[model samples]
Target: MENMHIVFWLLKDISWCMIWKPLGVAMIFPTLIISIVIAWRTRQFMSELCHNVAISVWISANSYWMISEFFHFDEHHIWGGITYKHLALIPFITGLLILMYFYLWWQPRNKEETEIIEA
Candidate 1:
């Protein structure tokens, strides 16, 4: 399933790079769905959950950016100097903050708990 997820992700990216609007837009569903499923399945493992969630967030941002470009609104500033493409940063930063929380706070504080759970 993970490998298939990767395949969908790559197809999405390849479609984006080629400016294939239909394929790119269509690929978003499977890519995002698979990532969500993976995240749900790994909910019991903090590390996997965090990583999978980040991947899902990333795919959302990527798809949004691709759509913005496909429809030719990517560079039109919505506020100040920020374009539609820049909105993707919201999810991008969210994913980063999630990883930071996991690595800097949750993981450290729960190390023993996780280890015991795994054992």
Candidate 2:
């Protein structure tokens, strides 16, 4: 009876540590990619809104991963302990910042019509 109880506890612990953690991590990539594609395909005001929202979501995910690493969330985990994991945030955040800067700053101003005076 004791052995059976131990086995059950062991499996439960392993399921939480091994199965759910990786599944959560795996969900981020495809979600980000699909969001980016959908944002790009959207038109006019919706396009800008979708793109910004997607970028924000991606940045938030990267920030969460960084926080997870700094607090040693992956210390004894099956995956996500490598140095490269933290480094991956650089390009993602950089690209998002650049895109935002261009969208907000570099876009051309719309011209307003003015009445022309005839000489």
Candidate 3:
């Protein structure tokens, strides 16, 4: 029946608002702590701090989206508008790039130590 379908859809919507949204917010804390530890260990303090801050901003945006989606808030008015969902990708990509840069270019070279030893 049409009524049954409507009820199912409404339940789905409510569950999305209540459960999944809060879960998204809860996920950010571990991410931030992990980022900070990794950054400190690598000695890229500034870049690590910047990247971690950027990730926090990104997580806040996600939390906003979760709140907005749950409350059925206005898509156009909120800070994390429906369109802003794509903003989550920015932090992820940025973090990946930072990691890659550290691994590929920023890591200290053993070659210099070897040359000094030979000299």
Candidate 4:
């Protein structure tokens, strides 16, 4: 009975690592291409490019994490005391970078509008 549970868990882990991870990584390019075409038609190419790049970074992090796990690279500390499993930081940092870039650098801020908000 205990062996059956172990087998099921192993199969689930295998499917996640082999099937789902690569599938997600593989789908990014087609989605980016489609986004580019639509953006060009709408004359919003730069916006779409930024969005696609951000998406790619996020997906790349997932792929990296899975690859690292499969190869056991995630178990060792590559730099600081934290283990390589912390490689997921790439995606997290990327998300924060984009969030700060858009909110701080790109968006237009006006004092009058800021003060008038009802929230």
- Local accuracy of candidate 4 as per-residue lDDT tens digits, 1-119: 33443343344346555656554444444543444454345444334445555654654565567667766688898777888879788786896687567557654453344345423
TM-score of each: 0.94, 0.39, 0.38, 0.52
Give the clash total for candidate 1.
0
TM-score of 4: 0.52
**Which candidate model has the greater lDDT, 1 or 4?**
1
Q: Model 1: per-residue lDDT, tens digit, 8-69?
A: 99999999999998999999999999999999999988888998999899999989999999
Q: Number of clashes in every candidate structure? A: 0, 0, 0, 0
| CA lDDT, every model vs. true structure | 0.93, 0.48, 0.50, 0.55
Regions of model 4 farther than 4 Å from truth: 1-14, 17-47, 109-119
Best by TM-score: 1
Which 10-residue window in model 4 sums to the lowest lDDT?
1-10
Q: How much does candidate 2 score in TM-score?
A: 0.39
lDDT of candidate 4 vs native? 0.55
Alpha carbon deviation, residue 103, candidate 2 (Å): 4.8
Best first by TM-score, ranked: 1, 4, 2, 3
RMSD of 3: 12.8
lDDT of 3 by residue, 59-109 (tens): 445545555566555255425444544554565666567656644664454
Candidate 2, residues 25-95: lDDT per residue as tens digits? 44444545544554555534433544555454654455455446544663444446555455546656666
